[model samples]
Target: MRLANRVRELRARFRLSQHELAEQIEVSRQTIALIERGDYSPSVVIALKMAQLFKEPVEMIFYLEEEQQ
Candidate 1:
């Protein structure tokens, strides 16, 4: 299974740039970019941080995607 997220959508909703979000979350801009592109899976702490920052639940921001059979 892979993790999927709505980081890009939510970030846009809040009108925050990747750099801005990264600073708010205390991560690198590249990390935010990777998460948005689904290239990297965030840790639980990171997910929670994102959830808190966006005022959203972690489940709403991230979910498990079953692999194709």
Candidate 2:
């Protein structure tokens, strides 16, 4: 399974720069970049806060893709 997130889309939709989003989410800009590039995954608590801040369902923001690696 591959972990993916719609962070870029949401950030654009919200007109938020990576730094801005990171501020709102209480994380570092690099962390946001990492998440956006699919290099790292946020924990459940952080994910929940991110979804709540954007008023989106967690599933809509993050998902698991099934594929053989």
In order of appearance, the predictions have TM-scores of 0.92, 0.92
Worst 10 residues of 2 by lDDT: 60-69
Residue range 1-69, candidate 2, lDDT tens digits: 999999999999999999999999899999999999999999998799889988999999999998676
Error of 1 at 18 (Å): 0.2
In the range 1-69, model 1's lDDT, one tens digit per residue, is 988899999999999999999999999999999998899998989999999999999999999899788
RMSD of model 2 against the true structure: 1.3
Clashing pairs in 1: none
Residue 63's lDDT in candidate 1 = 92
Reference-based lDDT, each prediction? 0.95, 0.93
- Each candidate's number of clashing pairs is 0, 0
How far is 41's C-alpha from truth in model 2 (Å)?
0.8
Distance from true position, residue 39, model 2, in Å? Answer: 0.3
The C-alpha stretches of model 1 lying farther than 4 A from their native spots are none
RMSD values for the candidates in order, in angstroms, are: 1.2, 1.3
